[model samples]
Target chain A: MIEVSGLTKRYGPATAVDDLSFQVRPGLVTGFLGPNGAGKTTTLRLILGLEPPSAGRALVHGRPYPELRDPLLRVGALLDAGAVQGDRSARDHLRWLAASNGIGPRRVAEVLELSGLTGVARRRVGRFSLGMRQRLGIAAALLGDPEVLVFDEPVNGLDPEGVRWIRDLLRARATEGRTVLVSSHLISEMALTADHLIVVARGRLLADTPLAGLTARFPTLEDAYLSLTSGHVDYRGVA
Target chain B: MRRALAAEWIKLRSVRSTYWTLAGVPAAVVIAALLALHASSLYDGASAEAKANAVVSPLETVAAMIAQLCLAVLGVRSITAEHATGMLRTTFTAMPRRGAVLAAKAVLIGATGLVAGLATLFPAYFLSRWIAGDRPLVFNESTLSQDLPSLLAGASLVALFALVGLGLGAVLRNAATALGAIFALWYVLPMIALNLPAPWGPRLGAVMLANLAFQLSGDPPYPGALMLSPWIAAAAMFLYGAAALTAAALALTRRAP
Candidate 1:
């Protein structure tokens, strides 16, 4: 379980995440939906303890993230797929991360196979294509086989097949009773994968409802999201 | 802590730059040896009267400074490279205790420095001794036993550079800025110290890293310069590393990634 309460972040004079409170329970795919500049990434950073919160606190499994023992074994995250050391091979990259959390090299090989990266595991990350990088990122997130998984914009550079792979992966992880939080601005993508929807706009919570609950009242999830976040869109192209 | 250490060990070896930096130690010794050969040639060419006045400073001494620079670069690359590549976020996410992670990195970086120091300084000692070939160089007058203390102190200084570079890297978070400060300290500041007015010149010079090994080993860099007692010089060396590390620790733990 992940709980965020009264969480706020301010950079200088501008507030990024403001007085937000929410809970992500286990056994479901919780889509963290927001438009651009909606503070989705900042909130995730706070929850991961990458940034100290300005106002409140975030709890994972009833304790703060930093306070947890073997954090990677409990919480796995893929914040940015391209944030790897390009000089390292994909296998070596995972091996170090595993070593950090006391996981064995066998798990590194396992994730490489699971992500279908065993063929290119010996290649340097700098030479990987975007799709390959995404796969490597996913492999890292699953390195520990944690109960809580967080993915930020995981499908941004994927092809149709890659997108389908992500959708199914998230669903499968959630089915195993793990808590999954995936953030994206694409409503259509969330419609296929998210069991619960937590929508926000302008750094404020707009809706925290189940997928079935919101879909029943609107023609589509996109209409429901647009109507709810009308003034909060910040920028839009002309029709 | 052990896990972090193990992980960092893997990190330290996997990067190609680490090997490149270690490779520099032998390469630096070779360069210094070539310079020594040139000095040896000059000494032989001079007339009998002029030969007595000519001096060749130990080759190991010259090479030690270069080795320190290489290790400092190694230290900076260990951390700042992660910052540049954005791998620090992933590291922190996996192990959120920023202090612990920083400590782990410092431990490995310092170890690399020690190994690098031993590798370069030891070989240069024998090579310089061999190259001088009874030419009666300034350092050649002393036997290996008499020079071991200074040589060990020199190796310690190299490790100190690694820590200094690492601390600056964390506090500065940019390789260019950290490396610039390191260069200024290692290369530029000692020259500026010598040009300063009396008392202060030798005083500052005495504390400068270039002079510490000599002073700590009971042989000041030069005559008439302030020569701190061996223990005091060692203490000063310790303080340099401690100050840099403390500053880096605070910088790393107090701020956001």
Candidate 2:
């Protein structure tokens, strides 16, 4: 389980995440919803201890992420697919990460097969297309088979088939009693995949409710989200 | 920490650059040693002073100087390449203890540098000795003993330069910029030190890496050169490497990903 309480992050005079509080329960796909610059990524970074929170705290399994004995076994995350050495083959890239967590080569091969990357596992990441890179990232996130998984924009560059594959994967992961938190701008995709929603705008929590409850007040989840975040968007284009 | 070390080792060896750099060290050493040996042979008809200068010193010194630059680039690339490719995020994410990660990188790279240094320096020394056969320099028990320390010093110098590169790479976080900084410090600054007036010129040259390596290896200091004793020079080079790594660790820990 993931618990975030009164979490806040401020950069100079700009507040990125303000008094954010939420709980992500196991066996559910929790959608972290926010408009552009709405602090979703910042909140994820804070949870992972990539950056210290200005106030409050984020805990994974009731302790800070950095305090975990074996962090990879508890929480697996893919914040950026491009955050890998391009010259390393997919197999080598995963091998090193696995080594760090004391994970063996068997699981490395298993994940490659599971992600449908076995064919290209030996190819350099520099030569991979964006879709192939996403699969590699997903393969890495599954390297340890943690109880909790976090992915930011996992389906951004995937083809239609790949998109469907991830949607099924997320649902299957949640069914197996894992806590999955996915952040995305695809409201339609989230509606189909997420069970719970945590919406934010301008770094403030606007709504935290079940998907059904959030969609009950409007015709669709997007309609309700637009209504709640209409005035909170950080940028406005010229009329 | 063991796991972190293992992971770092894999990361170090998995890249093509690592192989290129490791291979380049011996290639550079062999080529430089051959050239230096050729140059030494041409001193057959020179003055007694010139022959003395050529016979007493091993060609490994010149080869080591060239090899040190390659090892330094290897060291710098080890860390800077990670930063360049954003692999640092994945690395730090897996092992959140920032200092431990940096330490693992230092240990792995330093060890590789040491091994490469020894592998290249020994052969170069023996080859140079063979090439200088029949020269007035006698290979007595005392001279062989002296040669051993010099060989060790040359190897240690390679490792030290690698550590320096690692530290600078971590602090700078960019391959090109870090390489430039290291080049300036290793080559340019020493050149500038040569032209400076007294006391200061020797003082600066004394601490410069190349000069320190020379002194540590028991080579006669250049004219007007001021350098510490062998042990002190080794210690000083170690200190510089330590200082660079410490600064790198601080920068990594204090900065957000």
Candidate 3:
């Protein structure tokens, strides 16, 4: 389980995440929903200990992430799909990450097959399409087989079939008693994948409710989201 | 620490840049042989008085210098490439002990540099001596046993370059910027030190990184003999590397990915 409390992030005078607090429980696919510039990425970064919070703290499995011994064995995260060395082959990329965590090559190969990246395992990431890179990122996240998994905008570049496959994979992981936290700006996507929704806007929590509870409140989850997030969006096209 | 070291080694070996950068070792040996050929010919053509005055840079020194540049580049490439690509997030996420990761890089890069340096310097030392047989070159004046300390000292410079490169890469976090900083240290600092007025030139020049290996040999360094004792020069080099890595760890851990 991942716990974040009173978390805030400030970039100079601008507030990126403002007094945000949420708990991601085990055995559920928790959808971290926010519009663009909603501080979704910043919140994830704080929880993963990539950046120090300006206020409060984030905890993974009852301790801070950096304080954990071999943190990969406990919590696996895919914060960014593009955050990979283009020159490194897919297998070698996974090999080192596994080595860093004391994981062996067998798990690397397992994750590769699991993510359907075994075919192109020897190819450089530079030649990979966005969909393929996303798969590789997912492969990396699953390498440790940790109890908790965090993914940020994981399905962004996936095709329809890829999206369904990932949705099923996430649901399966959550079903097997894993704590899964997935962040996405797409409401409809979350509607199909998430069991619970933790919605935020302008770095502030707007709602934290189960998917059934949210869907029951309005005509559609999208309608509920738009109304909850009205005037909180940072950017919009002139329509 | 062991796991991090293993990971870092895998990272270095997986890339083509490591091979390219370490190519300096073999390249240095070949260059030394070529220079040996050039110098032996010069010695053969010269009159007795001219031959006595003739000298070329020592073989081990030249090879070690080349290896140092290459290893330094290897060190810089190791970290800066990760930073440039945002792969550091993944690395830190896995390892979390950011300092340990940097330390691992330092150890691996430093060792690789040292190995490359020794590999180049030893071969060049022997090969140059053989090629320039009975040529009365100044570089050939010392016996191998007597020259052993200087040869080892010269090879150590390669390792220091790699460490310095790693530290600079950590602090700078950009390949181009780190490379520029390295070039400034390797080339520009010595140039400026040489042109400084009065006693400052020799004084400053004595501590210059390029001169340390020469000083640490406990022999009067060629080109210009730096006055520092060998032990002091070794200590100064250690301090240089430690300072760079310390600054790097601070910059790397403090900065957000």
Location of the lowest summed lDDT over 10 successive residues in candidate 2 chain A: A67-76
- Give the per-residue lDDT of model 2 (tens digit) for A1-239: 99999999999999999999999999999999989999999999899988899999999999999898768888889888988889899999999999999999999999999989999999999999999999999999999999999999999899999999999999999999999999999999999999999999989999989999999989999998889899898886888
lDDT of 3 by residue, B67-132 (tens): 888888998989999999999999999988999999899989988888888898899999999999
Q: After superposition, how far is residue B123 of candidate 1 from its true place, in Å?
A: 0.8
Model 1 — interface RMS deviation? 0.7
Task: Indicate whether candidate 2 or candidate 3 has the larger DockQ.
Answer: 3
Question: How far out, in Å, is residue A61 in model 1?
Answer: 0.9
True contacts kept of each: 0.80, 0.81, 0.91
Model 3 misplaced regions, further than 4 Å? B222-224
Q: Residue by residue across A1-239, what tens digits does model 3's lDDT show?
A: 99999999999998999998889999999999988999999999999899999998999999989999888889889988988999899999999999998998899999999889999999999999999999999999998899999999899799988899889999999999999999998889999999999999999999999999988979999998998898798888896
Query: What does candidate 1's lDDT look like per residue over A90-180, in tens digits?
Result: 9989999999999999999999998889999999999999889999999999998999999998997888988998999999999999999
Docking tier of model 3: it is high
lDDT of 2 at A105: 99
Whole-model lDDT, model 2? 0.87
lDDT of 2 at A74: 87
Q: Write model 2 residue lDDT over B185-237, tens digit each, in one string.
A: 87899999998898798889898987787788766557668858988997998
Better of 2 and 3 by lDDT: 3
Over 4 Å off, model 2: B40-57, B136-142
